[model samples]
Every structure is written in C-alpha cells, then in structure tokens.
Target: MQLTNHDAANPSYWQARWREGRTGWDLGGVHPLFSELMQEAHAAGLKPNARVIEPGCGRAHTGAALAKMNYIVTAFDVSKEAVDAAKVLYANETKLELVVADLFALPSNWSNSFDAVYDRAVLCALPQASRPSYVHACAKILKTGGLFLSIPFTKLHISASEGPPFAVDEANLESLFEADFEKVCHIEKQHSVKDSKIACEMLIVWRKK
Candidate 1:
C-alpha cells in the first residue's frame, strides 16, 4: 500500500487508503511491546474488566487482544473500511465495539470514558503540525489518572523521500504529553521493520494527572 498525493491529516484520505488496501501501518497483529505491557499490568493486579480505548485503531488488533483479556474495549478509527473490518473480525465478541470516527472529533459519549488508552501508530501518523491537538484530544477522552500507553518512532534515520512512520524524538513526545499526564515510564527498544534503517523506538506510559 503506497500513499499518493493525499493529505495525511484528512480522514477521507485515510478512509480511501483503507478501502484501497493501502494500510502500510497495519502490523497484522498486536504489538509485542503492548502485549508485554498488558501482561505486566495484569501481573500487578490491574482489573481485567477495565475500560480500554484505542484511537487510530487501524484494524483494532490491540483492542481485540484486550477484549480477550476481559476488557471492555471501545476502539475508533478515521477510516470506515478499517472500522468495518474490525467489527467483522471481532463480531461475536461482545467485549469489543468498533466505531468509524476521527480521533480529534471523538464521539461525545466517549468523553472521560476510558480507564486506559492505547496509542500504537496514532501519534506519529498525524502530521507534526497536528500533534498538539491530537495529544489534547487523547487527554480529553481519558479519565483523570487514567493510563496511557504509546509506542512512537524515535531517533530513526530516514530519507526525506519516505515517511508516515515519522521520526519523533523524546523531547517532542515529552512536551506533548507532559501538560496532561505525568510520565511514569519510558522504555526504548531496537525493532526492525522491512526497508527501514530505524531499529530503535520508544514506548512510554503515563498517568493522567
């Protein structure tokens, strides 16, 4: 799936991409880091029925994983095709609900509705100019003291020619979340993705404060 002249910030562009099967961002499964983090959270006695929300939930794989663990999961994506695919994939699983909606304009019913939020490719998917509002919307939808888990691309060398897996350094990420949440943990790992030289990325956890 390749991007053309589409505007990255537009929901219609993303919807069209999904319909056209141009989802380069889809990992085909839940992220390993998120699986590990959820396991650790469970080990530490976090309730299995916690309300979880995932924005930009491409195919909603993470939400499906959480639902399997007994979470009340609600996931939304800007692409109708993506959301519809998720609904069909998770259909018979009462624990998961998928919605087609833009992250910044989340449904009013979701305000302060989640106990935890997962952001996999969401933050970096936005154009850098829209990041502040994107972060703000994430904060707005979370309950006070709610948990946030994010995996963002970091310190990656990329040619000006390729992107959408944009580079986001630690400082910019910190500045984005600091105002709305207290940083709890930040972990860096080396991961390999085909055709990309970037092997190091960051996973951050924050508690809404």
Candidate 2:
C-alpha cells in the first residue's frame, strides 16, 4: 500500500488496499470524534433525518452509526470492494445507503441534495492537486447552509513527499473553501496515529453560504 502522489489519484490504488486488507485507517468502528462533531453540529442546529453524504467512505462505519442516530446517510467509496463490504456489514441499517461512486463525478440528482457532508478521510487522502475538486464536489452536493463536518489529519506520520494521510494546516483549509463556506466551529485535539511524531488533529465544521 505504498502510494505515490500520482498513484493516490487512481481508484485502483484504493481498490487494491481494500482487497489486500491494508486499511490502516479503518478503525473497525465509529470514531469518537464523529460523536463529538455530531453533538457540536446538533447544538449548531443540525438535526436528525437530515440528509448526509460521506465521500470516500471506506467500509462506512461512521455512516452506519449516523443512520442509527437517525440521519439519512448516503456513504460512497470509489472502491467497489469497500462499498460491498460496508453493505454487508450494515445490511440491516435501513437508513444507510452504500454506493460505489467517484467523488468528482457524483450522480446528477445529487447536486444540492445533501444537508451535510461528512468527510473523515476523503480530503486528506487525496493528492494536493485534487483538493480543490474535492472541495467543489462536496459543496455542489450540499444544499444552501448545509454543514460540512470534517476530521482531517493535521500532521503526517510519514514523509511529506509520500502520503494518503496528508498533512493539512488551517491556512490550506481556509483557502480551499473560503469561496463557498464559512468557518463556524473548529477544535484541535490530540490523536493516536501509530508511530506518528505529531499527534495533532482537527475537527472543523463549516457552514455553506
């Protein structure tokens, strides 16, 4: 699962990871950061039954958890293997929908259809060149005033030159979405990525305007 920046953009890279069970990012269950983010967003007016879309949602543990919390969750990944695994893992979650789709080429009907976009791995997983497009796709699918909850890896464990878990700073985040979103809430906290020198992470919620 050693992916160069160019290989990171190819869907086959992710497909191979899933097939080989090389998903170090898979926590095997919903992360507590998601619960905290939901609580903060709910205080900020997000409610159950709101339509939520999660792009690059490998295995969809968070999506299924959100569905149980009453959100209408649509979680998709470029890897069919990942989506298929998610479907089987949470087969009884009626409110959860799993699909194999590219984030940049989502279905036409999805435009401005989601009330929120949950991004745990998508942004940081992509190469720097594709970030603007990722931000655009998320914004396009979200309705006006929709929330975008994100947990981006703020520090890289490996070399800066090679990564799926890319390092992102506040400036990079702001510059990318300033045109379409306004920062409403932000929290920085410690994380536990194995062998990582920096244990910092960020939970940010932006409101679409």
Once fitted onto the true fold, the runs of candidate 2 whose alpha carbons sit more than 4 angstroms away are: 1-5, 192-198
Q: How far is candidate 2 from the true structure (C-alpha RMSD, Å)?
A: 1.9
Best candidate, lDDT-wise?
Answer: 2
Tens digits of per-residue lDDT, candidate 1, 1-209, equal 55553267767668777877988777787876776677545543357899988898988999898898899999888877898888888887789988888887777888888888888887777777788898888788888978888778886676423556567888988888899998877778776444364667777788888
Instruction: Give the top-scoring candidate (TM-score).
Output: 2
lDDT of each: 0.78, 0.86
Which pairs clash in model 2? none
TM-score of 1: 0.90
lDDT of 2: 0.86
Tell me how many clashing residue pairs each candidate has: 0, 0
